[model samples]
Target: MQSDSDRTGLAIGLSLVALLLFDAMGLIIKHLSEHYSPAELSAYRNFFGLVPSAIALWSSRAWHAKGRQLWMRQWKVGCLRGMITTLAQFCFYMSLGLLPFATAATIGYADALFMTALAVPLLGEKVGKARWLAVGIGFAGVVMIMGPGSQSFTPAALLPLVAAFCYALSGVLARRMDADVPSPLINLYGTATSVVGASLLTLALGGFSGIRGPGDLGWIVAMGMFGGSAVLLLVISFRMTQQANLAPFHYFGILFAFVLGWIFYDEAPVDDLMPGAVLVAAGGLLIVWRERQLRRARLWGARGPHTRI
Candidate 1:
């Protein structure tokens, strides 16, 4: 049998790969945003992304063992999540087009802070002083990157911040889903809804623009595949180990984004990201540390103080 440590190692590897794929998708979106509307790009992405979700659902052994159940109890919640995700994608894609790649990507990290704050009201979770302080620190970093009063700051910077909030809200709401419903199934519902929502958004935004060229078409397809495959890998990683084991590694994504932005776009925003990015990372790590402590405490309490380690 595979040891717990080995499984965790494998899960971390998969998580890192997933983050890289997600960053690749972001790169493609940034590249294509020059010619396509965010609404159209989102619609195309969801349409192609549905294939991987379907494949993941079909291959789910647990879902298959339960007779391939297709319906979920929280279908409305799934749809709402999809709608919110569409908004998130639209905003983030717009930011990618308007701002520097690294800057937009770094600002989007605020989603972690938003997720932590939202958990209090959304999940009825109690917030301790440490986590609250971490949130404040993370927000301060976000404000520094945003540079609200600085001459360089533009309202466009707010797009990724809004995107981060919507993304965090969608994630927090996912916790309310029926546990018995397979994750892949829930993902499919959201992806399907996103397809419809994105389509409507495209129509509202004056319909899809003609594909700029064959090369752009190819990039769009690649973008969808990268996103879909990342989601699939994440599902596999989640199944293999505890989420907390993988959560901290998500910070690696900022590093990946920074490197990619520097290499591909010649964007070195050291001045913009500097100490702010450090605080953002530190704050998130602090939250992760506190969550681990609480989890360990709960486990110890459940052992009745008499169980062996």
Candidate 2:
């Protein structure tokens, strides 16, 4: 029992760490992109992040022995996830390059709404009316932020939205994957695959990008470390607390991105970011709350209806 408590506390800490780490990712990507192409940055992030973990796993003789599928056995599913993640990361990195980190981060927040909306058709999960309303309200707020009608749309603005959609799909598949394999194994393979693919794509486009020195190499490595730790910590977090309780914490990334933008890039957010942030954050919170409420209702809803006593 005490172990469970300890684990819970550790999980919460890891989760917060994961959120902050993720918050750093876009800013870091943006910074690196200044010196390296998106493909170069993406490759470095994916490759370095996996290589050390892979070595650690190898020395431990883990060699993915516990993965539900044999090496390459889960290729189809794994590859599907890999592709989505690859595109998502690329788009996100590109967006950071093109837009303010805070602005792009705000747009990315809509991924929860995408994921919630995605559950209905793809997974056959029943989305209650409240959840539907939440998604709609949240998306409406997104339009406000983007200002579709009044402002001319820039192609760059779509980057985060594209990233969100790909990520949402990948997220759903990840749940299916969790039932089959350890999260670490799945992530390890995916990272390795994504890095390799990204590198090849980069080289194919143009060879040997701005990797001209030692300092750049160090930041690339650091980016990898942050990313890897985040993936692992997030898995730990989800296991600790209920998704509802943990869900609101996602918004912290926006805050992290905002501060980083203000300090380093000197980029500040406008009034547009707040309303959407509030609506999306509020909608997500309410959806979670409504889920819990409905859960309680269900437990009692059929109590007297079907009982003969």
Candidate 3:
């Protein structure tokens, strides 16, 4: 077992790397969007993404008796979660193709706010005024980023909002799931769902007529490899660090995405998006920090009165 300090450092490092990989995956998606429809890209992403997920599952041997039984027990729930995730990813990829990279990414920070809000009714978690205030602040940030009624606002901007809500719901569902179901197994199911759903979507959209030969192969592979590896990195990181400590690091993806957009697409940040992104990040971080404090207090209370020398 790792010492507290060492574990903290490793977790932070791994979290940062994971976020970078996720943002890199986004960059690849954005590039490939020029060549493929969102449905087609999602299908490719899900299909190829299964590669690393399979490898991880096999190497981990998470299919042993109990694990296999747990997986079978949860397959139905997994399918539902996978369907939700596929929809969320499809909306996000659509937004990526339509909106500025940083803006789309910044809007996704709303997932934290949405998760907190949803947990109240969905998970029966009690929320105090301060946490609600934080969520409101986060929403204000989202409104600012979305800039409704502004000349630049497009209906396309709503895509990330939809995606965030779906993702948040999925997060809550995960919390309600059996802890014994391995993450890799869950990932496998999710990718399988995405593959099936996205393929149907592609067919509805008139199939993958946009394929431009072997050049598209690189983007497809990059999307899958980066996305799958990022999931593994996050699983490893979260295993080492507390979720609260890692939560704030997720916002760092916006920064990475901004840099990538500038380098690859020459896309500059929108003036309104930066301040809104800050508000969203600050509000979400405040909520996470407050929750951590509350958890510690509860733990301390459960420990009962202590005598000091």
Candidate 4:
């Protein structure tokens, strides 16, 4: 049997794999988007992705979650969170088309910062002063990465920023309701919501006539495969590992983005990006570290005063 520590290590390692899977997903989606609108890509990805998701749910008998119907629960929150996630995914895809893989990944890291801010409002969760300070440090690093008012800042970069905000909002919602809903059910509903939402928007925006040719469809299929697997992998990791144990590995996505850019997209990583990347990463790292410390502090605080020897 795997020891608890061993499993935690494995889980953290798997989460890093999940992050790279996210990076690989960007390249695939970008290629597909060369021929498709973000909506069309989302529509197709969710539609095709459902086939495998359905199979996994059925095989694992995850459909019968707690013997309770979804309607009996907070269905609105789930769908709303799914919509926010859909929008976030859409904007991230948009940025991938307009920016280099690493650049877009770096820009999207702002989502973590945005998430921290939004948690206070949406989840009514109070982030201690330390995490708040860490958020500032992290965003400062992102600003260095972005270099606003310079040639590096462009209209396109804002797309990822907006995506980050939406993701932060959705993440808060997901965390609040995670225990009440089964992971598979959440995936099922979220996938369906994305497809329906994307379809309606596609029609409103003039339909999927320009989505892609056959070659691009292949890329979309591959993207959907990686997307589903990444979700499943990350979900498993969360189940097995403490987030602090998994947090450092999350930065592997940035490294993966850099590698993919050079290998496939011919993007040459630059020097300015490194310092900012390190700053932003360190800030985010501190945020997680402080949050973990606060949890321990609060736990001890609740345990009553210590008696003097």
Task: Tell me the number of clashing residue pairs for each predicted model.
Answer: 0, 0, 0, 0
For this target, which candidate reaches the highest lDDT against the unseen true structure? 1
* C-alpha lDDT (0 to 100) for residue 305 of candidate 1: 75
Q: What does candidate 1's lDDT look like per residue over 166-266, in tens digits?
A: 99999998888988888999899988988899889999989988888889889988888889989999999999999999989988998999999999999
**Model 3 accuracy (lDDT, Cα):** 0.84
Q: Give the range of the ten consecutive residues with the poorest summed lDDT in model 3.
A: 62-71
Candidate 4 on 2-36: residue-level lDDT in tens?
Answer: 99999998898888878887788788887776777
Which ranges in model 3 have alpha carbons more than 4 Å from their true place? 59-70, 307-309
Following a full C-alpha superposition, what root-mean-square deviation does model 1 have from the true structure? 1.0
TM-score of every candidate: 0.98, 0.86, 0.94, 0.90
How many times do residue backbones clash in model 2? 0
User: Higher-lDDT candidate among 2 and 4?
Assistant: 4
lDDT of 3 by residue, 1-309 (tens): 879889978998988998888889888888888778888888888888888787766655445645553245677777787788888888999999999888888898799999999999989999999899999999998999999999988998899999999999888877777777777777788778889988899899889866576777877888988888887777777777788888877788878878888888888876958688888988899898899999899887888679343
lDDT agreement with native, every candidate: 0.92, 0.76, 0.84, 0.77
Worst 10 residues of 2 by lDDT: 55-64
Superposition error at 124 for model 3 (Å): 1.1
Q: lDDT at 103 for candidate 3?
A: 86
